[model samples]
Target: MKILVVDDDPMVLEVLKHSLAHSGYDDVTVAQSAVEASQIIAKANPAFECFLLDMSMPEIEGDDLCYWVRQLPQYASTPILMVTALANKRDIDRAFAAGASDYITKPIDMSDFGMRIQQIDRKNSQNAFKAPASISLLDKQDQEPDRIDFSKPVHLGEITGEVDLASLENYLLQLSRKGIEGLSAFAFTIADAAKFHFVCTTEEYLDILKSTGQIISDHLAASGFFLSYAGSGSFVGVGQNANLHHDEWEKTERSIQEALAKVAVPSSLGLPSKIQVFSGVPLRLNGKYAERSLDILYRTIVEAEDRCGDTSWAQV
Candidate 1:
């Protein structure tokens, strides 16, 4: 595939080009700025198949450039992956909102990059064979339910084997009362739960959920955190010394993605499964609002879910 990579850092550009080349992507073009990328796009007879953009760039930022590329008729649905060092939730939200298909944080992991590209290729291949009418039909069928039944009780052991939602909330309340430092809550959900349920057997779907919960539990447990299944595919985690550092969060996110990617379903399922993880760190814990820790945690998870579409992550 013809790929265009845009980045201002010479080292990053070289490393990415070398990595892509090593991965057998020979028709790779490098651009130092968005302006240069635009020029390349304008002059090409056959358009680039995919884009790797640096989120932070001179002239036009990657997110803005992604938006601009989507505006072009030829590139509207082309995969545009954001390659950047910005790992915060806000940056991720902006990138996706502005039309990024996927994102990779810097100091790139070439193996992960290859897997992501392969996924995009598989999706594009699947899409290429689909008729427009059928595509429309599937899109309509996948529309989210107007009301989700979050009140449904989930057997905690059947899912993540962690504590129930009420227990998690009580833990958070106790921590708040004791004046915990560096407390952070994280929420995770299976992004393609609707489709998974429609396609896979109940046993298979539950297995996937169990694996997902274990992955999250294992990762958080290393940091001495507590995790719980919050029903409707949502999992919440509370950590006292999460430190709220961007690098730490990025590492955790990468671990989650790696674990999820290993999960295999039938190719007939025709869609990639994904997990959406959101981190909520309260910036203030003073005065009357301090007593409402559970409320804050719930709101943060809700905000994270609202900000992230299917197969994405965000922080609030």
Candidate 2:
């Protein structure tokens, strides 16, 4: 993970480079101006994982530089840190509006700087997010266990990890991040994660699903989306944010058409497959949509066999 330090002051730049090096981050790049920073960013390909920008540069003010960084495809999602002496609320808001992820008021307190770096490093860790505690379900007789509760928050980042082909057990453990309810619109493609049989067997795939379900509730938190699963290949997710009314459903159908046409799935098993997404409003609970707010993603295997055409696979 590379960190780009952008500031016009040569002495400040040198100090930052030296300080960060002392702090054990070796891949630091310094840029004297926003123009130079942009050039470095472009040539750096893959982009820097994080950026620390000095807000007082004349070539491009820090806030403006942040805005430009947000405009670039590679840096749009990258974590950006703004360094400034300005502690005004208005300036902080502007930095956020300009797409800065976090800000540091300068005069560079070494202790605070170290703490901020630690915080960002934690966020960057794949396992930083933790799943919420398990809720107890009551039984039919209201005795021990069996009653279900469906109200809870869903956090996506918790379960995602670096995918590895050599480890199936670890991969499944990582997938515990997703609650069963959130996967209602889910679809996946087998990637042969353990290299089992080159193409995963249905039984083995079912085992993986069953094991993951033990961790969280199955079925989605809400309804109105279709799900498909790919085992061992590539997982795809699709979601619909539409209504059942004729007009809304038609719009959703059109959206699916465009999504299917434009959606690009990765090449797997030497074949090109695309995921399909359909959207619809889940059944109203107290007249409101719930935590499954983001569109669910679906993965595809064969085109015709797994195409999520114009219908809901199962209602929530």
Top-scoring candidate (lDDT): 1
Model 2 quality (TM-score): 0.42
Q: In angstroms, how far off is 273's CA in candidate 2?
A: 35
The candidate 1 region of ten consecutive residues with least summed lDDT is 130-139
**Residue pairs with backbone atoms closer than 3 Å in model 1 (clashes):** none
Query: Candidate 1 lDDT, tens digit per residue, 96-209?
Result: 656566767777778888887887777677757543210111234665323322333243343333544543554455345345546666676666555555555545555666
Model 2: per-residue Cα lDDT at residue 186: 33
Model 2 bad stretches (over 4 Å): 127-316
| Worst lDDT 10-window in candidate 2 | 162-171
* lDDT (tens digit, per residue) of candidate 2 on 1-316: 5899998889888877887887788889999999998888888965687899988788579889888987675554566778777665456546655656666776787777777666666656653363222222343675543212111111111122211111121112112222222222332222222332223343332333333322112223323322222332233333223233547544544544444444333333632243333333322211122222231221122322234341222111
Runs in model 1 deviating more than 4 A are 131-316
The per-residue C-alpha lDDT of model 2 at residue 178 equals: 23
For the record, the alpha-carbon RMSD of candidate 1 to the native fold, in angstroms, is 16.6
Question: What value does the lDDT take at residue 76 in candidate 2?
Answer: 44
Residue 312 deviation, candidate 1, in Å?
Answer: 33
